[model samples]
Target: MPVEIKLFMCRTDNFGALLHDRDSGETAIIDAPEEAPIIDAITHSGWTPSMLLITHHHGDHVEANLALKRRYKLRIIGPEAERDKIPGIDDTVEEGSVIPFGEERIEVISTPGHTAGHVCYHLPKAKAAFTADTLFAMGCGRLFERPAPVMFESLKKLAALPADTAIYCGHEYTLSNARFALTVDPDNAALQARAAKVEALRAEGKPTLPTTIGEELATNPFLRWADPAIRKHLGMEKASDVEVFAEIRRRKDNF
Candidate 1:
C-alpha cells in the first residue's frame, strides 16, 4: 500500500501532520494541539487516526492527546524520556527507533533542547521530517527550557539530513523569522530573495512553510553561523560555531 503524507495547519497556526496508507487505510497524527481541528482534518480527509505521535510534552503540542485518544481511541507515542510528562503514552521511543506509520516507517531522532525531550520524526521514504519547535522555516525555536549549546547540537543533527528533506515544523513563524534572519545575514542574496518571496506569500494570505533543508542550510542564519561571512558580519573574533550561534540566537530573541 502506498502512503500519503498530508500536511495540516491546525489549531491557530500550529501544524498537525497526518500520514495515511491507502491500502491499509491507517492514519497517524503527528502532534495534537486540540481535538476540533484534528477531528476536522480526519473527517475532511476521510481518514481515521490509528496513532498519535507526540514530539514533546509541551501543552501546546500534547494537550489534546488524551482528548483525542478518548475520541478516536488511538495509540499515543512519544519520547521515552518524557513518558512521565505525556498522558496515555502507549509507546515511548528513543533516537534511531523506527515506528510503523501505515506502510511507511518514521525514524525517531532525539533532538532535545526545545524541551529536553523534543524529537523530529523522519520518514526516509517520504523525505519529510516533523520537526516540532526545533527547526522552523527561516528560524530556530527559542532556547527556552534548554541552553543555546544544546539546541545548536540538536540543529546540527537535523542539518545532517538530505538537502531535500521537507521540514514540517510547529509554528507559522516564517515571515517574522525571515525578517530576523535577514538582520543577521543582510548581505546574503539568498536570504534577501527568500524574504521577498515570503513577503509576497504573506501578503497573499498564504503559508510560507515546509521549507526544504537545502534552502535553510543556504539562507537560515541560525543554521549558517559557521559560515565565514556571517561570522564576519557578527564582528566576533575567532568565535566558535556555538559562539556565533549564541550571538545569532540572542540577537534573534531580541529581534
Candidate 2:
C-alpha cells in the first residue's frame, strides 16, 4: 500500500501533516499544530485518524493533541523524555524505535538539540521523512537544550540517509534559511539557484519546503560544514567539522 501525505499550514508557520495509507485507509497526523486545520484537512481527505506522531512537546507542535484525541480515537505517541509534557500521549518512542503505520514502518530517530527529546520520523519505504523542527530545508533548529555538537550529530544522522530522501520539515522557514545559506556559501551555484527559487516561491506566497536530502546536502550551509568554500569563508579552514558547524550556527543565530 502506498502512503499518501498532505501538508498544510497551521499556527502561522507550523506545518500540519496527514499521512494516509491508501489501501488500509489508516491515517496518522505527524503533529497536531492546530485543531481546526487538522480537522479540516482530515474531513477534506475523508480519512479518519488512527495515530498521532509527535516530534517534540513544543506547544506549537502538540497544542491540539488532547483536543484531537478527544474528537477521535487516536494512539498518541511522543518522545519518552517528554512524555509527561505531551497531552494525551498514549505511547513513547526513543532512538532506534520502530512502529508500524498500517503496512509501513516508522523509524524514530532521536534528534535532541531542538529540545532534549526532539525526534524525526523516517519512512524508508516511502522515501519520506518528517524532520519536524530538528532539520529544515536549508538550516537546522537552534541548540535550545543541547550544544552544537549534539545537534550536528543529529543532522549527520539525517544526512546519512539516502540523498534522494524527500524531507518534510515542521515550518516554512526555507526562504530565510536560503538567504542565510547564501551568506556563508556565496560561490555555490547550487545554493544560488536554490535561493532564487525559494525567493520566487515566497514572492508567490508558496511553501518553500519539501526539500530533498540531496538538495540540502548541496546547498544548506549547516549541512555543508565540510565544503571548502564555506570553511574558507568562515576562516575556519583548519577547524574540526564540529567547530566549523558551530561557527556557522553562531553566525546564523546572529544573522
Candidate 3:
C-alpha cells in the first residue's frame, strides 16, 4: 500500500517524477517537464500515469503537459491562482486543498514566491513532498514574482513539516547550493558533511536528492532564519526573522 516515487531527468537539471501507488497500481506524474524522458521513464517502469499534478505554470515544468495529457488522457490538477497559465488543468487546487491519489491524500501547500502561484504537494501517509521549484535541496527557487518577505513565509510552511518528512525537488542543485551554504555557515559540521556527500554523489553521476526535512533543518541556511548563530554570522542578530531571511536570500542571489 506504499507509494513509490521515482525521479527522472527532464530538460537539463529539471526532475520529473512518477508517484505510483502499490495498492492500486495507479500512477501520478508530478510535473511534466519533458515528453520523451517521461515516456522513457514510463516505458521502463511500466506505469502509465492517470493524473498529472502541477505546481506552477513555468514552461520547463509544464511544457509536456499537453503532450502527456493527450497521450495518457490524464486528469491534470494545478494551482487555482495560475489556472490560466497551466494548460489542460482539469481541477484547480490551492492551499488547504486535499485531493486523493488512489488511496493516498495529497495536500496542497501554497508557496507563492518562486512564482505567485507556486505550490507543493505533500502526501501525509507517505510523509513525502514534491516541491518542484519552491523548496530545493539546500537552496530555493529565484524570486521571480513575489518579494523576499513572501518567499520567506512560504519557506516557513515547508520548515514546519515534520522533521522526518522526505523532500523531493525539481533540480539537482545541492552541490552548488551546499557550496553556497558553507560560505554562510562555515562552522556547521552537518552542512560540511552534506556538502561532501553531494560532491561524491555528483562525481559518480548519481542523484543527490530525497533530502529529509530533518537533514535540511540541520543544514539548509534558508530554513535556519530563526537560528541565533546564523543571525550573528550574517550580522543581523538584531533583525527580525523576515529581515534575516531576506538577507540570506539576497546573499544567495548574489552567491
Candidate 4:
C-alpha cells in the first residue's frame, strides 16, 4: 500500500509532517519542531508514532525530540554526522543508507549547506522527499554552515530526482521565496504565475507546499542558475553555473 502523509503547522513557520504505513501500523514524524502540536496532531489524526526522524540538530527541528521519545518510546533516526547533537537518536544514517519503514525504504540524501549535517529523506515508492531546510517551494535554505557552491551541488542532487516527486520541506517560507525569486527571474512566466498563486494561497491562509520537482525546475530561481535569463539578469551571462548560483545565494541573503 502507498504511504499516507499528513502536514501540519508547528512552532513559528515550521511544518510537521507524518508518514504512515497502514499495513504495518507504523507512523513516523518527519521532524519534531514542538511537543504540544506534534502530539496533538498525532492524537487528532489517530495515529501512534513509532519513530521520529530528525533531519538536523537545529533547535526548531529537534526541540521536541526528547519529549516525543519519552511519550512514545519512539526510535529516533538522524544524520550520522550530527548524531551527537540530535537528542535521543537511536540510529544514525548518512547518504546511501536505506531505512525500512513498513514496505517502503527511506533513502537518505546528505544535503549539507544550511547545516553541515543536514539530510533529506526520499521514499521512492511514495514519490516524496522530506527536504528539511535544503530545498523550499521557490527557494533554497540560506547558506549557513557551508558555501554556496556546496549548497548548489546539494540542490543539484535533488533536482536530479524524478520530476514528479513531491517535496515536503520544513518551513512556510514560500511567499517570501516567491517574492525574492521575481527579482532575479522577472521574465519567467511560470514563476510569475506561481508567485500569483502563492500570494492568493497566503491571502487565504493556505499552504503552498508539497511542490514538485517539475514545478521547481520550471519556476524556482535557485534551480535555474543555468538559465540564460537569470544569468543575464544578474549580469553574469558568461559565469559558470556554480558562480551564478553563488551570486543568487549572496543576493538572497539580503533579500
Candidate 5:
C-alpha cells in the first residue's frame, strides 16, 4: 500500500499534517493545532483518525487532542515525559518505540528542550520527519521552556538525520527566519539565494516548508554555528559549540 501524506496549514501558520494509507484507510493526525481544521480535513477525506500523534504539549500542537479523541475515540500518542501536560494521551511512547499507522511505522525521536517533552516523529520508510518547533526551515525554535544548550543538543540529533529526509516543521516561520539567518551569515551565498526565494514565495502567499535536512544544513545559521565561517561572521573566536549556538540564538531573539 502506498503512503498518502497530505499536509495542511492551519491556525495562523501552524501545520496539521494527515498521513494515511489509501489501501487500509488508516489515518493519523500529526500535531493538530485546532479541532475544527482536523475535523474538517478528516470529514473532507472521509477517513476517521485512528491516531493523534502529539509532538509536544504546547497548546498550538496538542490543544485538539481531547476533542478529537472524544469525537473519534482516537488513540492519542505522545511523549511519556509530558503526560502531566498533554491531554488525552492514550500511549506514552519513548524514543525507540515504533507506532503503527497502517503499513507505515513511525519511529519516535525524543527531542527535548523545545519543551521538556518535545519529540519528533520519523517514518523511515517514507523518509519523512515531523519536527515540531525544534528545528525550522532556516532556524531553530526559541529556548522557551529549557536552556539554550539543551535545545542545541536536541537540534544536533535532528541535524544528524539523512540529508534527504523531508522535514515538516510545526510553523511557517521561514520568511522571518530567513531574514534573521541573513544577519548571522550575511555573506553566505546560499542564504542570499534562499532569502530571495523565500521572499518571492511569501509575496505570492505560498507555504515554505517541508525543507530537507541538506537544505537546512547548508543555509540555516543555527545548524551552522559550528562552522568556522559562521562563527567568524558572528564575531566569535574559539567558542564552544554550545556557546556559539547560544550567541546565535541570542542574536536571533534580538534580531
Candidate 6:
C-alpha cells in the first residue's frame, strides 16, 4: 500500500505532517512543532505515532519532542550535528544516511542554511521530500546560521531531485513567498498563474502546499536564480548564479 500523508497546522504557521506506511502500519511524524495538534492529527487519522523525525534544532521544530516521546515512546531521530540540542533524539543521522520506515527508506540530505545542522528527509519511493525550512513553496529559508552561498548550494541539492517530487515544507508562508516572487520575476507567466491559484486557495482557507518540484522549478524565484528573466530584472544578467541568489535573498529579507 502507498504511504498516507496528513498535514496539520500548529503554533502559528508551522506545519506538522504525518506519514503512514499503510502496508506496515508504521507512522512517522515529520516535525514536532507542538504536542496537542500533532496528537490530534494522529488521533483523527487513526495512526499511531512510531517515530519522530527532526529536521533541525530550531525550537519551533523540536519543542514538542520530549512531550511526544514521553507520550508515545517514539524514537526521536535528528541530525548528528545537532544531537546535543535536540531534546529526545535516540538516533542521529547525517547526509547519506538511510533510515528505514517500514518497507520504505528515508534518505537524509544535509541542507544547511537556516540552521547549520539542518537536514531534509526524502522518500524516493514516494517521490516526497520533507524539507523543514530548507526549501519553501516559492521561497527558501532565511539564512540565519549560514551564508547565502551555503544555502544556495543546499537548495541546488534539493533541486536535483526528480521534478515530480512533492515538496513538503515546514511553514505556510507560500502567500507571502508568492508575492515576493512576483516582484523579482514579474515576467514569468508560470509564476503569475501560480500566484493567482495560490490566492484562490488561500481565499478558500486552503493550504497552498505540497508543491511539486516541477511547480517550484517553474515559479519559485529562489530556484530560478539562473533564469535570464530574474537575472535581468535585477540587472545581474552577467552575475554568477550565487550572486544573483544572494541579491534575491537580500531583497526578500527587506520585502
TM-score of each: 0.96, 0.99, 0.98, 0.99, 0.96, 0.99
The list of candidate 1 runs beyond 4 A from truth reads none
TM-score-superior candidate, 2 or 5: 2
- The digit string of per-residue lDDT tens for model 3 on 107-171 reads 99999999999999999999999888889899889999999889998999999999989999999
Query: Model 2, range 1-255, lDDT digits (tens) per residue?
Result: 399999999999999999999978899999999999999999999999999999998899999998999899899999999998999999999999998887899999999998999989999999999999989999999898899999999999999999989999999999899899999999999999989999999999999868899999999888988989899998999999999999999999999
Worst 10-residue lDDT window, candidate 5: 1-10
Per-residue alpha-carbon lDDT of model 5 for 1-255, expressed as tens digits?
267777777899898899888777888899869889888888888877788998999889988888889999889989999988889888898888899776788999988877888999998878889998999999888888899889988899899999999999999999999999988888989999999999999999988978999999999988997888888887787989999999999988898
lDDT by residue (1-255, candidate 4, tens digit) is 469999999988999999999888889999899999999999998999999999999999999999999999999999999999998999999999999999999999999999998999999999999998999999999888999888999999999999999999999999999999999999999999999999999999999889999999999989999999999989999999999999998898898
Residue pairs in candidate 4 whose N, alpha carbon or C atoms collide under 3 angstroms: none
What lDDT is reached at residue 60 by model 1?
85
Q: What is the C-alpha local distance difference test score of candidate 6? A: 0.95
Q: Give lDDT for model 5.
A: 0.88
Candidate no. 3 TM-score: 0.98
When superposed on Cα atoms, how far off is each prediction in RMSD? 1.3, 0.8, 0.9, 0.7, 1.3, 0.7
- If both were scored by lDDT, which would come out higher, candidate 4 or candidate 5? 4
TM for candidate 4 is: 0.99
Q: Sum up the clashes in candidate 1.
A: 0
How accurate locally is residue 175 in candidate 1, as Cα lDDT from 0 to 100?
A: 89
Better of 3 and 5 by TM-score: 3
Q: lDDT, candidate 4, residue 127?
A: 95
Off by over 4 Å in 4: none
Alpha carbon lDDT of each predicted model = 0.88, 0.93, 0.92, 0.94, 0.88, 0.95
